[model samples]
Target: MGENINFNIVLFEPEIPQNTGNIGRTCVLTNCKLHLIKPLGFSLDEKQVRRAGLDYWKDVDVEIHESFEELRKKYKDGVFYFCTTKGKKYHTDVKYNRGDFLVFGKESAGLPDEVRNSDPDRCIRVPMINTTDRSLNLSNTVAIIAYEALRQVEFPNMK
Candidate 1:
């Protein structure tokens, strides 16, 4: 059998329940694990999450981390790729593989300086219009990058 592709979608202090829920649904659809850091603006168990994700919540594999350090301790071998508009490298340029973790920050502030600068070598960004000053919606951005990573890993015979 082909090796299982262990993909993880990490949200650092996510701020919106709907966006998180949508990301959760995407994780379920793509067979990727979802990891969320604490201090979320909206409750993960909120009705918004349930409403947005609908029945997809049951299929999604989700892990809640109290802190990045907590998660880092558990997943050492995985590549941590932080997504940011300020990143010098494009997401497409990364040679994504199994056990790669794609991390996104909060909607309002993006990744904190310490976190964004934690591993500059692993930061990735999506190309966007120069005329526009803002990034894509959190859910949309996550779906785009996660699917690309999934595609690169051969989508791994997902069920």
Candidate 2:
């Protein structure tokens, strides 16, 4: 993994432990930072989370924040792109850069209107087939957007 991590994946009020664990593993493999905003639905020590992350949990650079506001305050100058179903543009439409923050909302409800609307131009979403009423799984959604951004930057520090 790279010593200088360039991307961050932020989960706001994530509900599922398994999903978070999976995302954490992805972060570890990609050398990206994982920022989790409370309140999480499951304990960080949950067995399911460990199982989902397999043996990669400890390698993940995970940061826990009390709330979205706290995270925002910490990364005051960060370039954040909120991912939501209501976003006007597709995730692929954006030209991702290093040090960009990719934010995903809770499993049940996506990002709040206030957050999504804060910078409408920075909001993005994965396209879905109209036949389904459900959105993509949280872990899958994170992987999709993360990889796209990583791809845009030519998968830095990856063999």
Best by TM-score: 2
lDDT (tens digit, per residue) of candidate 2 on 39-153: 8899999998889999999898999999888888988888899999888899999998888899999999888888788899999999998744689999999999999999999
Tens-place lDDT per residue, model 1, 1-159, is 113535889999998888988999988888788899988888867999988888898778888999988888888766799999889999999998877889999999899888889899998999998844699999999999987888887778774
The per-model lDDT (C-alpha) reads 0.86, 0.91
User: Looking at candidate 1, what is the lDDT of residue 29?
Assistant: 81
Ten-residue region with minimum lDDT total, candidate 2: 1-10
- Note each model's CA RMSD in angstroms: 2.3, 2.1
List clashing residue pairs in candidate 1.
Answer: none
Q: Where does candidate 1 stray beyond 4 Å?
A: 1-5, 131-133
Q: What is the lDDT of residue 34 in candidate 1?
A: 89
Error of 1 at 58 (Å): 2.1
